[model samples]
Target: MADDDLDPTPVPPRGRRRQARFELEFGDFEPAERGRRRRRGTRGTDDRSVTSSDELTYETADPLPAPRRPRDRDVIVEADDATYDSRLVDRDQRVRGRSRRARRADAPPADDVADEIEALERFEDAIETVRSPSDRGGGSDLGARVLVAIPAAIVAILLVAQGGWIFVVGIAAFGLIGVWELCRMFARTRPSLVASSAGVLAIIVSAALWGREGMTTALVASIPLIFLAVAISVPPGGMPGVAVTLLGVVWIGFALGHAVLLRDSDHGGGIVVNVLVGTFLGDTGAYLGGRLFGSHKLAPRISPNKTVEGLLIGIVTAVVATWFAGLYQDWLSGTDALLLGLAVAIAAPAGDLFESFLKRDAGTKDAGTLFGPHGGVLDRLDAAMFAIVAGFYVWLAMGGVS
Candidate 1:
């Protein structure tokens, strides 16, 4: 017999009593909902029926739900695509004002929200600038380069012509500025700009006053001062700071001294002019040639733009330009001109590469921006520094100087 039949006057089960109480309290507000609940209760009772053996069993067995299929990669991907498409459709509908009220429900106040949006926009712009290429030192303007170079060339010529304390002072000024730039480049080493500048000035002045001997003396003497300065000012990374300090002194200071020595030599003005012509012309030639016909890299590791073709063209241009410049100076013979041209040509590129190496190590595109569109003082004179030194040695070898 059914359980309901057995419980005819059995004081109604607890569940039936509770259902009756709920119905009495709420009355029949919704007859359809009440009928649905009654059907569900009947089904549940059938699920827990008892057989003649007093063992509970389902009156009509309902098979267990079919086991869910394990999802493969393709099925998961398809589901994700479907979800994304649905989201896109929903967004489109919202933009068309189908859910304007719903969308505005959790939004912040208008003024506060506007300010937050503006702040976010500014932050994104700042981050974009920070993410810009680090090697973007802009000195590529040709007109600006020429404008700066012309005045600079005139000043250099005037200084070279006035060989004395004026020239020495000029060289000292260059050394000081170069020291400051180097200190800046390696600022993390905490190199003292004053100390390095003093050392460089001493080296240049001594070269002018006492030639090679005084220059050597000053270099040896300045080492102690540099050491003391590094210890006093830049206490950390002592060795690196000292090394960088000495590097500026030797590299820039010593090289510029050779320019003084060159000027002191006999017929120095014409010779200096010839060297400048060769060095600058060679540089210009290399630039043009590389732009026109650069196929193979000259030094891919040190400088990406340098090319073998450009180097050859520069050598040829230097030789021709030097020979042409030497025509005005009767003392410079064919052999001497050739030798000086080749030396300057080779040494100029070496100096340029050396500076490039330094910049690469320092992670900078230019040493400094003092020259505006031409780059730093070092950038402009890097090749000239080596070329001048090379010309001096050639002059000494040829017995142009007593």
Candidate 2:
């Protein structure tokens, strides 16, 4: 046989060549069903052999199952402000979903909702009860009252300027008014006639004997007598009555009497003026500061509206006003003035808080409406009364006028 005709090295067939090429380019490519087909075919024919061409045909014939069509439930519906279906989502499921979303979104917890609701309700209640300054007649009444008070204050100052009976009368009248306000406040809780009368008498006697040598002795003697009177007159179960009466005598009577004593001191008029101005400035500063920058509560239980920022402003203004008053009147040295200012700063807030405590206990907003926007005499005098008593003691301790 000719060498060309009878070729010893045979070339691969077209299908074999293609299979070899495919194996080289895409190694080990086999259809998933190839093994299953072989197994099925071999079950009947034990000697069946799987061919590469069969595997290749199977790999080429099979296509991935048609891309899955998403079901209605699988599709997420997203809308800007779309309302949910009420029939699809019941109340419980809706609430649960909302709570879950809130938690996932880092929102406030469900428990805080009740607290916020309560706070808002309280705010609404407060708004209903306390009218704004503008709403309450545009402050015209306040202005008119101020005009009236200015003259009255000037006259009192003039009376205090004179020695003897004039000062006594002025002090007695002021103390009596304060006593009346206090008695009126406690009237529903107790019979305040005896307490009011006793308080006025004590104030009169204290003022009358203020400058005398035996004044302290008389003042000391009156306390027991006042207590005894209240104790006897007040019913057995009427401790509040006795307490109010005693409180009136001590607070409205003796505490206010110190103002008279302050007036009788060497630079008495200046001392009284300094205290009054300082306290007024403190109150004004607190009001403005609270209105402007108040955030943190000072005493939420006693006075929810009071703020720490306002208290700080009040203290600073009080100190500055007091120091200026001292310098103006030449009543105290710079250092002594500063000390008195500090005292006033501390005592003024204390007095205001004290009255707030009383009013809160008595279930009223103001002690009276005599001063219009200023509330009542008690409301206006609360801080001053405390400041005066504190200033008098400080004066005595510092051995009177520096």
Candidate 3:
């Protein structure tokens, strides 16, 4: 063979070159299948020009699948605007898909769809109906409240009757539990519950043993311990966490500690009973009054359900209840009972609102669920904390206690 014959890129003749002898057998292949084969084989040879308008329907005999619309794109149409289409249009000037209303319009009316719409409407109505004024003060949870409150009240009375180290221990235990609940509320801040509980226990015990001075000393000393606790925390919250821990100890711990001091005083049982009766009766009156006749808000920003009418009713109820309770005890005068009731009335709501403020800031409905529907220990004692402190002062002013 010649070297020129072996060259792959040989020049064609000046005239027409002879074509190669090639044969393709189609056998039983259809016209479209043959056309597709030819097009694919001659892709870069320019044998066929595929235009944009050509629909390659022969790729498969089955029709093209419809584009899927996202389920979340279904818009909730208002009852009033049920007939209106809410389909959106993109920059491409094409409707995204059928909206909820549009689909409902196209489909024949069915019982299931109508039932779903009706159910949604009923759910909204149910929500509005349950939003009662008493929601702030137990509301539908009254049964649970009563069940829990009864035993708790009896125990508290017994503790007051038995005034000694036992009473001190009871108060200290309450302070510890309250502080724990408060610490849990500041969980994000990583405040130390153990350290805070210790601080609260110390404050309560010191108040019982060495009086106010000892309690004051413990409160001051606990600050360093709290700082150290937060310092070694896995994810420390720095100075802010320290402040939060101190708040829990002082607000809950110190407040309950005053109860110990009150119980140790002259005519302490009577004084303590007077404060409890007044505070609890006032709380109950507020709830009942608000449920029945609450229209004007007392503090809409702080506590929406509280009403001015309820507060007035509570004040009157507290005064009456305290005076009645005083009749049982010879040492507490009617006038002094009335004064104590007034003090409790003012302090209780203030304490409740203060806790509400804290809960609102913490973005929680309740501090904890220790007392079932009544909420945590803090929730049950919020008003009592302030009431006990006020009662202590009132008793001191009357020279009943040293």
Candidate 4:
């Protein structure tokens, strides 16, 4: 054979290339039978065209096989302002003899859409974990918590103008708010105005009675006297009313009342700083350590965020915080300061988780709305009040606030 005859045909231009061909094996013929065929070649009729044996040539004289119809396309889209055409445009737009499909590529497939929805739900959960309830910026935002903390910081700082009185005022305001929150927390179950008033009265009376009338009188009044009055005013079988009322009297009334007394001292600012710094340091250290090295969950049912690692770090941080407070106050040796630090480290979180338990039982994210950016004033100050009382008791036991 001549070399020119033996050579394969030259490659066609890119645009003039034939459609892709498929190789059929014993079992691979089904898909090709279903696919559209290239219709460029016509049947033997015109002089210029060539015919291939592969195509089905139908004639009147030859017996015909069963007619084969093409399958219809199945596609559906649902949009708010949609304008889809019912007609199919068959032209050069599609490969010869092949159908073209039109739809939004960004729109996920029906099967894949479930995954996207699951991812969106996970994103929302992550946002809630990082942000506080009051930290919303018209929606979910983790920085909302910091925005709330800023105002609280400003209030704490500017109160230097009030000298010793700031502590008393701050404590008293916190006390009343704390009492109101406790009342509201249990108000839904027991909705008697008289009962609510009695609870409120019991709180105020306990604080005054303890702060002035002494611990013995306050304890007596808080137990039998308040409960007796509450039992009479509140209807029978209202444990929520009775228990919460007594709890409010002791937890808010007496503890916060003592916090005011501490703030009114000569170094009240230092005392307030001590309680706040110790409690906040424990909270901060716990959060960071837990995120970094949380191998085991601590009290998962009550507060899942806490961890063993976080608790230990919190204790160390509380000690450091108390040392700083002692330096600022210029009172107490390192040992006494360390003791108070240890006390706050252990007690503050107990108080916090206790409140978290109450909130969980109540099916509430916040105690109330008295505080705008911090849920409720009680929610903001619960730990502070608890730590202050515990620290004060320790200070008195260790020679009474130097």
> Candidate 3, which segments miss by more than 4 Å at Cα?
1-141
Compared with the true structure, what per-residue lDDT tens digits does model 3 show for residues 1-402? 233332232222232222121111111111242211111124565444333333222221343466977453354355432222222222112232334444665564456656876566545433633556476464454555578889889989999999898888888777777877787776766778877888888898898889999989999999889989988987554555777788988887778788988988998887888899998889889878876787888886566667899988988888899889999888778898889889999999899889988886665668888777568888888999999999999889999779
lDDT of 3 at 180: 77
Model 2: per-residue lDDT, tens digit, 155-183?
A: 75687678567877766776667777787
The Cα local distance difference test for each model comes to: 0.74, 0.68, 0.74, 0.60
Higher-TM-score candidate of 1 and 3: 3
Model 1, runs deviating above 4 Å: 1-142
Clashes found in each candidate (C-alpha, N, C closer than 3 A): 0, 0, 0, 0
Q: Higher-TM-score candidate among 1 and 4?
A: 1
Q: What tens-digit string does per-residue lDDT give for candidate 1 at 246-298?
A: 88888998898888888888988778888888988898899778767878989
Location of the lowest summed lDDT over 10 successive residues in candidate 4: 19-28
Compared with the true structure, the alpha-carbon lDDT of candidate 4 equals 0.60
Better candidate by lDDT, 1 or 4: 1
Measured by TM-score, the strongest candidate is 3
TM-score of structure candidate 1 = 0.64
Per-residue lDDT for 230 in model 3? 85
Give residue 65's lDDT in candidate 1 (0 to 100).
64
Candidate 2 weakest lDDT stretch, 10 residues = 80-89
TM-score of each: 0.64, 0.62, 0.66, 0.58
